[model samples]
Target chain A: MYNILLFAKRELRVFVDTPVGYVVLAVFPATMAALFFLAGSFFAESEATLRNFFTWMPIAMALLVPALTMRMWSEEIREGTEELLLTWPIRLRELVLGKFLGALSLLFLTLLATAMIPMTVAYLGDVDGGVVLAGYCGTFLLGAVCASLGLLLSSLTRNQIVAWLSSAAILIALNLLGLAATARSIPPSLAHALETLDLGLHFYSMSRGVIDAADLLFFLGLTLFFLVCNGLVLERRLRR
Target chain B: MMSPDSSVLAVKVQGLKKSYGSIAALQGVDFEAPVGAVTAFLGPNGAGKTTAIRILTGSLLPDAGSVHLFGADALRSGQDLKKRVGYLPENNPLWPEMTVEETLAFAWSAQGRVGHKMSAVERVVVSVGLEPVFRRRIQECSKGFRQRVGLAQALIHDPELVILDEPTNGLDPLQVIQIRELVRELGRQKTVLLTTHVLPEVEALADRVVLLHEGKKVVEGTLAEVTSVKAGQQQFKVTVNGSEEDLKSMLATAGVTRLESGFPSSSAQASAVVLADGGQEIFEAAVKHDLVLLELAPRSGTLESLFYGLTQAEGLHV
Candidate 1:
């Protein structure tokens, strides 16, 4: 537990010191607001809620979370510091969990940066605070999922560009699976299973202010799955 | 097989084997470093020196072997055993963005030690002479100072065993001497295992030598033991003002097998390696032929010659 916090603290410091962290923080909220107000047709809808922001948040996170997590393991491998880190008296799980938490904390801050979006909606109309809170909750959970998947792909390679591209590609595919167009192309049975597996679909369920246990379980389970796979990849490297 | 007294051995490995695809990195290699000694792991590139060090440091897993450190099963002992061993891997990898102070503090905290953090960092900082750059970020430091930071992190927790792989690999001459001096100082209190291909490094810092060749340990002993010549044979580098035939005849009479001989130069000075005692007979023959013996020095075996001989005999392109 102590080692995990130590690694997490160091990782957070790295993120804060590097330009990538600021880039993600700036771009995520700006893009979220642009997509919500411009492409989302906020005036046309005349909605009293951040429904459009929630709608675009998953897709935006799919792109930006990879950028946040790409260098988590890839840079260590590239710099050859992985040897120094692993040889320390820390467990593999602690390292992975700590890095995951660090990236997630940054994602949380990115989410918090968009607080004005919710405030603007409330000032303009009677925005339901419960639904707004649920939407943020869902987005945070979805970002956690993306963070873990990005971290896993990062561990598979030493090149940050490769890690970013591969993770972005997979996360985008998972998001697309939740779309109606993708569902129409597949058979009903296959579409049902893919929809259940779709990460965006789980977030959508939570964004509706339901907070269903099934959706929460899906996000937590998938995150754990990716993290475990990351651990296995590191273990394989040790043996190899 | 276990040693008779395992407690005295800081590190012990038996039948350690590791292969990447079809290429074997380590093959049934066994060696030990006694407590409070500097053991030099000498091998050419691709000779599995780094691979063996990685295994000992718990950075890699062996296919089939046991690693015992300070009488404990290191392979399974986990953090408790790891805390006792400090490793500075090859190339001295470190976070360039971190200040020297943060690097030491991180390393100390990573060991799970509570309290005394400031004192621990102070001790290692003083020991490795890192005070000047203690607040400087690693990226701004020179290679020598970066190497000192690497050493400082390894020693932050006051580990019982310090394993340094190529500690002075890319340093300038002065830096090499300074690092060697620090390593020698560390040897006064801790068990030090250093790996290098440089012969003088072994002579300068190591108390014992372990030579690995082609994934196998070819020799292991004290410095003198590993470099000792066999009985009844002696090597001499003799430069004499004599003809080739005179040198050859003199060597034949002296009962010396010529390992190598050089051609006579402008001054008719030729040198030859003769397997005899001090070339006393060759000296007599030189006198008989009126050949001015410019030099006759007994050539002692060196780690370089032994390393090359062993590697070359195995058809390796050393």
Candidate 2:
């Protein structure tokens, strides 16, 4: 626990000390906000509510979260700092969890900055505060899952670009898995299996002011699975 | 068998082995490093010196061996054991993102040590001789200071045993001497496991030495114990200002069983004299003949020669 907190503090310090964090924090909110306004004005039929704003996030995160997390472990290995960290009296799980939580905190802070859009929606028309709260919960969980996936992929390679591209590819596939329902000939069982893994379909259920136990379990389970895998990979490298 | 008082063995390795697929990095290597002593682990490149240090310090696990640190099983609970061991890898991986003070504090706390406040960090910084640049970001620090920061982190926990791999690799001669002195000072109260190929370093600092070759322990003991002179294989160098032919004939008749010479024609002061056996008899005869000997001394074999001699003699390149 102390190890995790120590490392997490260091990770946060690193984020604040460099321009990379500021760039990610600014780019995600700016790009997502711009896309939301453009789609609302030119393409959508009605004013953009928190639903429309939340709908654009997973797509935005597919690119942004990978950029944020690609350097978590990969850069450490590339710079040989991983050896230093490994030699310290730190358990593998604690080290991984520390960095995971640190990255999650940064993402959450960036997500918090976008609360103005939902607050703006509340002023314009009748908006269910429960749905808005659920949307934030679902979005945060989705970001958590994405960040863990990104961190796990980042652990496998030292090349940050490779980490980014591979994580983005995985996120894209998982996000679009439910959309394969367009193939009319596809069987229901196979489609259902794909939908269960599809992050987009789960968020759709959350956006409708409904939070299913399965949806929450899916995100939590995926995050835990990837984090465990990340820890295992790090343990193997340290042993080697 | 070992004792707690007289034999403060900081490290004890037996049947240590590690392999990466088909390549065995360490093979049945065993050694003992005593407490409050500087033990140099000498080896050529790829000779598993770093691998052994990593295993002892809990960074790498051995495939088939047992390592005990101060009599505690190193493998069974490495994290618990690591608190007692400070390791400096070949590359000093100082965190560039943090200042020297911040980095050292983070490392000190990581070892589960409390009271490593500003005073503690400042003490290590001053001890390693880095007080001038404690506020600088590590990325901005010079290589020597970076190395010092690495050393400072290792020393912050004040571990019982400190293992340093190639600690003087990048330093200039002056910095190397300073680090050597610091290490010697530290070794007075703590066990130090230093690795290097430099012969004089081991001779100057190490109380005991282990020479490794091809991932095996070739020889390990006090400096004199490994390089002691024997009757048949004694070695000496004699410098004489005489005719090359006369020098060779004189050495041969003086009971110098084997002699090899490489003298330059321009300088009579230059002459090569190698005697394989009967060093004292050859010296006495050469002196009696009134040979204008420039210099004569035993060719003190160093850790470098010992490493090359043992490794090459064993037909192992590394």
Candidate 3:
């Protein structure tokens, strides 16, 4: 656990030290704001709530989170530093969790910057603080899932572009699972399973102010699943 | 030639074998390095030197072999035995995105040490002379500086065993000397096992030499034992300044067994073989013939020639 924190701090410092890290942080909020205000109709609604703004976050993060996590393992493999990392005394679990939470911490801080949206809406009119808090929770879980999936793909290759493209494809496929399950051509049993696995369904539910235990478990479980896959990939490399 | 039966061995390998796809990287290689000695692993490209080191360092698993480092089974140990062993791989890799200080700190912490990390970082930085570039990003540093940084991180933990694969691969001659000095210093207290193509490096620092060829150990012993007198083959270069007929008659009477040439021109470059303990007879023959010997240098084996001879299968160069 201590090893995880040490590496997490190292990863956070990497974000600060590099100009790209700051660029990612800055551009995410701007793009999220643009998609929130310009792309959607927040002013069109009577209620002064950030529901529309929070609704589009997971879709935007489908692109943004990969950008943040693409270089996590891709760059390490490309630079041959993975060899050193693999041989170090640190456990595979420590290294994976460290980088995962590190990316998540950055995701949290970036979300923190978006607090102005909720604060602005609250100042203008009455807003449900419960829904707003739940929105942040859902977005955080979605980002963790995206980051873990991104890290797993990063472990597949040394090319960040490949990691980015492959992770984006998987995230898009995940968001479409519920729609696929709704198709009349598919069997009901398989459709039900697909609906249960649909990531967007859980993310949207949490964003709409409903933090069901099942919904929370869905996102957290998916994140853990990908992280475990990432760890297995790294462990396999050691045997090679 | 000699294994320390009483003293502890820092590294021991037996029947080590590894294959990549259809290519065999190592084929039943075996060697051991005792404590506090500099052992040079000499071999040509694709000679299993790096593969052997990787297995010893616990970074790669071998197909059929056993490796013991400091009495810990490399194949079975689970508690990060590598923290006690330092390894600088063939192409030393570092985080180019991080500064030199950050890189060293990351390496130090990766070992899971609890004490203040910077003190150990400072110690290695000084030991490797990396203070000047402490704040420079690794991408901004030169190749030599990057190699030094690689060495610093490997040494930061003060490991009991140091494994350097081609430690002086690419560097200026002076930088090579500096690294060699640092490695020799480390050898005084820590067992240093290094692989280098440079024969002078072996001569200057290695107390023992393990030469490999085509993924197998051809020889392992003291430098002198391997490079000195092969067997009963006595070779010498003689330059006699006397008439050919007179030199021949003198040599025949004085027990010089075989001359490369039936008749020798006085003072010409020629090789001669004498009977057992017959070097004295050659000198006596030269004196009896009144030959003014310009050169009488004895031709003995050198590491360079021995390496070439041992690893001459194909594509092997010094």
lDDT by residue (tens digit), candidate 1, B27-75: 9999999887889999999999999999999889999888999989988
Residue lDDT tens for model 2, B1-318: 111233767789999999878999999999998777788999888999999988887777889999988898988874878888888889888778789999888888888887737788988988889988989999899888888898899999888888999988979998889888888778777878899987778888887788888899988887776665422355566677777665665565575533334446334644543535546666676777667766677775545555555666433211
Instruction: List the pairs of residues colliding in candidate 1.
Output: none
By TM-score, the better pick of 1 and 2 is 1
For candidate 2 chain B, the 10 contiguous residues with the lowest summed lDDT are B257-266
Candidate scoring better on lDDT of 1 and 3? 1
After the best TM-score superposition of candidate 1, give how far the Cα of residue B68 lies from its true spot, in angstroms: 1.2
Give the poorly placed runs of model 2, Cα more than 4 Å off. A41-48, A181-185, B1-6, B229-300, B314-318
Residue-level lDDT tens digits of model 3 in B49-132: 988887887667898989988888888897568888887888898888788998888788778776888899888898888989
**Model 1 TM-score relative to the real fold:** 0.89
- Distance from true location, Cα of A104 in model 2, Å: 1.0
DockQ scores of the candidates:
0.83, 0.63, 0.51
lDDT of 1 at A62: 88
Scored against the true structure, residue A228 in model 3 reaches a CA lDDT of 100
Docking class of 1: high
